[model samples]
Target chain A: MPTLRRDFESRDDLIAHYREQFPEAAAVSDWVSDTRGGRDAAEALLDNVDPVEYGRTRNHLSGAVTRLSPYLRHGVLGLAETRDAALAKVDDPSRAYKLVNELAWRDYYRRVLAEIGDAVWDDREPYKTGLDAEDYADDMPDDVTNAETGNDFVDGSVRELYETGYLHNQQRMKLAAYVVHWRRVRWQAGAAWFLSHLLDGDVASNNLSWQWVASTFSHQPYIFNQENLRQWMGGRFTGDSVGGGSPFRGEYDEIKARIFPRA
Target chain B: MNENARDKAVIWVHDEMLSLSWLGYVRRAAERTEIVGAVFVFDDTWVADERLSLKRLVFMAECLEQMPGVEVRRGDVVQEVSAFAEAHGTTRIVSLASTSPRLRRQGEQLGVDWVCEPPFVELPARIDLKRFSRYWGKAKSRVFRTTEEIMEQA
Candidate 1:
């Protein structure tokens, strides 16, 4: 079949054209329709670097995180170029160490993919949790995808991901944990779901990070409690603002007992 | 680099690497080989994959708009690239080296000239690839050096 070629007057036009041209991809939302491309935008993002603040508050939802992954993933900006950009902005390159380390993690995952190849799609090691790899569900639950997980924090993150094609790093970790540990879904399923929606998604980074959360690549499976969400997110999703009491509201021990009753 | 022969070469710019780094190769290649034109092929297999979202396609389209004379075609990679090169009467095809298995396989199938760009950080050929810390330690000196130092050395 011939590839469709046409000019988009605006981003909405491009999105409309894509939806009409490829109806099969309709299940995946075009929420991130305004993503700018090209070298200039990438450079502008790089130029506005705050490596010092990024180190201190990158974990928070309102952190000084550099939203440069989509550009980096697409190779509009190379890792070396981003590193040099960071170094140029700072008086000392060490100030940019946290940011550089994050970038290196991306490179590390790529190298891992290069070495392991198709194995990345499989469990790198057996699950560390009590659960068996085969025991986990191969598909993500529709409730989770529909942002009706009943947990405000998780649902909010899912909504953000669908709307913006981006999520805070900490939010991703929590969501991945919720999928693997709480919902008893396989990390591969979650990874695939994420890859379909994420603008910055790559097979290597996304899958490996999911594997890490699933404890197939890490020492322990990551799990979170209600207090952790409240502390970081405050009343943004949980509390009186949403009127839906936090599903995650519980003590750590209670959460552990509830999610891992067998243990 | 045969100056006269280069005038007839074809440059294939993949969507994965759209930065000036790839452009540098195109410009340098154009200097030595015949610059038939640059081509970006949107592989049908990828388009058909549900995982390939509209955002990525739009992003690629925007990138392509910046490059002059970059023909955007849709078809099987090998056939489209080969037909384009053949149409231009040039067997020579140039592309940036990529770590993606798919891209590497495509390169082999196309029998194109691959150009290796300098990595962000260079690691030893046989280093343990299991962990980032190990790889980062070996590459620290090279990666952490100031741009001015690199430029001065160059």
Candidate 2:
């Protein structure tokens, strides 16, 4: 029922819009802007996202355009009104369907939140065991923090996370697989990072999606190989590439050399 | 049974906002039924635990805390309703007819006169009739959807 639309391309732009729109209202509160670590998170994730390729990328381009989740979550915008506005703009049913699916997934996760409770946080036993112990032997907790383990992908991603507080969805999967399987750190740790940084973060979606990638809950855990990573990177894997050539480039012994030298 | 001394009303909400919606219903029903206000009940376990986020919990708490004219009781659905009914000394229960089978069964098992209130209320007579008529038309259009069906022989 209330029409409130504020548009800006940068943080300074956003600030300008806020000041212009709510001159009488108090300056935007820290609770509204900073607490979630919004600006830093967005910059981190957006770092690796090439501006030219950003609009062309498949995963989150639509999510980027609307960028209404935070507003919806905070009740600053109404869901039905937003849906009506989107449908009115786009004539393509398929695009509309895609947007609708994202929205529906929002509702689905909410329902799952109501039903599943703590079970959502539990680890996937089969995948935990199914993986070769060697696959995880070198997984260090610091892989998340150190980031500079000779893997440009991991380093760039961590930097992206530190800078933007967001990541391309595809990159999120790649990073999750890298840490969970390739590096073999726990998924919960990675999910916590996502929750801490992502401004658009919803606990149910972030946690459950992480668990899904971790192969903890699904019938089969998703252990992505180097080839899949290459495909997502648009087949771009130099030493400068995120994971450094094939995730399987070096054998189990070689990965140990690169990531876990002391072992 | 006597019509004048219904004594109490139970608002059967099938969803989250049912508390607010039922409160409105009780106000309208007061004109027709001899009753006090209403009681709101929820099945704590039936709701998804993940959805009870800190933000949502805070929001629901605010709603329940601020509600002025009605009493709110929360617990396992049947237990709360039965307990409230005994404590308040009322038999007449008012509930929204939830499309959910579980809720409908619960209502049936309660074995009391339950009024199944509609979710939406028609506009009161005092508002502009033309605006209300337009709203009524648009509401019907929004809800109606086309789907294929096969006629069956009885």
Candidate 3:
């Protein structure tokens, strides 16, 4: 029942105060996210949201995602109010349709979590991949955890998560795919790793989305090839050969065939 | 109706409802009653168990700073809420509703009252939740309605 100090001269002071208070966490990762929290910050980001451009480029890493997840996750911005903000921005309601639809995904996931409770950590259904859950390894590979994976995209994405405590949705999905499929690790291990790092990490969205990629909560598994990776990387990373050959380099048919050999 | 009754309540501001609007909702639900305390507890055990990074705590702290009425504490939620209420001589505890099982458990332990936030969208009572598309089928029209239109329907 200890009270936290309410006084701080600046953000540095605030970080310093928390570091002293939570030394174990500071020891784990001293990195602090630039994404500030609170209503002022949330409203500022909300004011700049361009729903039209968001629809066009949101799939790409450089897209205008509104970066409102941390706020939304913490409930600093009401979901309904945010949707209304988007609607108010455009004359025709359809222009804001994509953003609104995406927000609904959040609501949908939360409803599932509410119903299932602790089962959010459980596999919602059997793996759609021909492989059994037993086929996946229980431990996260050291290479992936250490961000020492030879794959440029994989390593870059992991490092981005550690350094920023945030990832573009593309980065998140790509890295999740690599962990669950490429390394053949169970999705739970990968989800736990993300929970430790992501600013917006929550049981509902994080675990279910991982299950979506692992094919345990969706119709099929998610996989991407070199071209798809490069397109979304937005030039921040290379899809070029790593160590003289790229693992992601191939057509979806070839990739799927390799990834799901038993299928 | 009396001032003594008005001062007998506390608000448990859990992690999910850190917004100003949530606070406003709690206040309105109190019906002009003077809430003696607004408390947010940092579940250190849960954080350590999850191995959450320091950045997450910092982000939460930042959020708390923006919340004008919340008293920040580090400990078990139930104990902190109880200690806070005892200190302020409050017997009634209230909070905005959340889907988090942990929060719900703690809320029940503290005998907290829940006020539901305004809905993001209204759906049929038995809508399919197995897939996003299925839920969207039932949620889209209601979500797409303008606020004015939604209010008018209400």
Candidate 4:
């Protein structure tokens, strides 16, 4: 094996070079400007974490989520460094506890991966919901992938994921549930799609999370009603924005009755 | 570990552990175990999958550029690593221990020296690996402890 040496005069040049090699990834060329990969940039992002705000807004679409997953996923920054940064931000260690706990989830998944190895791709346990693993379809719906799902929130999230190579954490859960439960698609299919696009996609984190939504790793399937989306995402992706109708617009009980009639 | 002994060792940096501190730690393990060179191999078998995103490749390339003198190669991981070691005149290969099953398997196959970094959490000897809460309860104290404290305990 011989060493290959090449240099980029600018970030744009690098993106262009990458595009030439992988033309199918043109949807994400614009994303390169937002994410500059290197140690210094990672440290700078870590230095600006706000634990208090993060605890409050993490569940919202426009949350104060520290977009540091790309660096953490790639090993530009370590878990200890991020945790230390969170603790340094406030007087009480407990104040940063929520942020640290989330970081710990990443570590937890890694440990699970270490133990399970390739079995992470398999369901850890049977689905808690009425349906069995064999009941789900093996392929992702083209409607979902192409952002033509007719559901405003889901479509918006899909576009965000493809165009930016990232998504809000809450949005990820909702989307995962939609794919696994609502659409009856296999969690593995959704996981692969996410891994192909997410800048922070680690196999353990992404697949295990999909399993969680699919009820294979959790107590119950994670299904969200339209009201829940409306509460968090505001009116931008509901009602009139969705042509005066939305599949996710009903009350929780109505959604439960409609989506899971057998349950 | 004599001062001159360091000159013979080669540090193998993989994509999973790109931190300078990790490399520096491995380099400083012995008085003169100065890194003769570092190598980053892009395994063709691993990257052939559809899930291997271009962004990750670009990010890895950027990371390799950060290291002062890391030689990049493309081929079988074990073969590339072995060739680099042979060319550098050192059979000893040092790398950070990784959780990836593939990387761990490669480490064993290459017979490399693996260094364990301080983990995000330190678990009890007996752990219920089924759930996150149970794991967190057992490892929370150590997880929140500073790196300095961890190093002191080590």
**Highest-scoring model, lDDT:** 3
lDDT by residue (tens digit), candidate 1, B27-90: 5744666667678887768666537666666676676666556787777888888888878877
The candidate with the higher TM-score, 2 or 3, is: 3
- The C-alpha RMSD in Å for every predicted model, in order, reads 3.0, 14.6, 1.8, 2.9
lDDT of 2 by residue, B29-148 (tens): 545554554554534553232212222222222334334444644556676666666555566566543323455567777654544333222223333222223434433333111111
Q: What residue runs in model 4 are displaced by over 4 Å at the alpha carbon?
A: A21-33, A234-236, A239-242, B1-7, B30-34
The docking quality of candidate 2, as DockQ, is: 0.04
Q: What's the DockQ for every one of the candidates?
A: 0.52, 0.04, 0.78, 0.50
What local lDDT score does residue A85 receive in model 2, on the 0 to 100 scale? 41
Error of 4 at A127 (Å): 0.8
User: What is candidate 2's CAPRI-style docking category based on DockQ?
Assistant: incorrect
- Note the Cα lDDT for every prediction shown: 0.76, 0.47, 0.86, 0.77
Residue A2 displacement in candidate 4 (angstroms) = 5.4
Query: Fraction of true inter-chain Cα contacts (below 8 Å) kept per model?
Result: 0.52, 0.00, 0.77, 0.49
TM-score for chain B of all predictions: 0.84, 0.55, 0.89, 0.86
Model 4 chain A: lowest-lDDT 10 consecutive positions = A24-33
Candidate 1, A1-263: lDDT as tens digits: 45455565776776677667655555556654466777888778888879999998887778898989888887888777788888877898788888988988888888888788778889998887777877899899999999886666777888888777788888899899988888889999999888877778878889999998998888878887766765666457552215655546578778777776665
* Clash statistics: count for each candidate: 6, 23, 0, 3
Tens digit of per-residue lDDT, candidate 4, span A130-176: 77778889999999988887777888888888767788887899889
Instruction: Report iRMS (Å) of candidate 1.
Output: 2.3
Mind giving the per-residue lDDT tens digits that candidate 3 earns over A1-263? 28997677799999998898898888778899888878899999999999999999999888988999988888998888899999999998899989999899999999998899999988989888789999999989998878787777888888889888999988888889988887788999999999999888899889999999999999999988888888888888775545668778799888878888898
CA shift of A120, model 3, Å? 0.5
lDDT, candidate 2, A78-196, per-residue tens: 33433444444444433444444454444445445545555556653445435543455432467565576667667777666554445667677777767776666777767765554
**DockQ, cand. 1:** 0.52
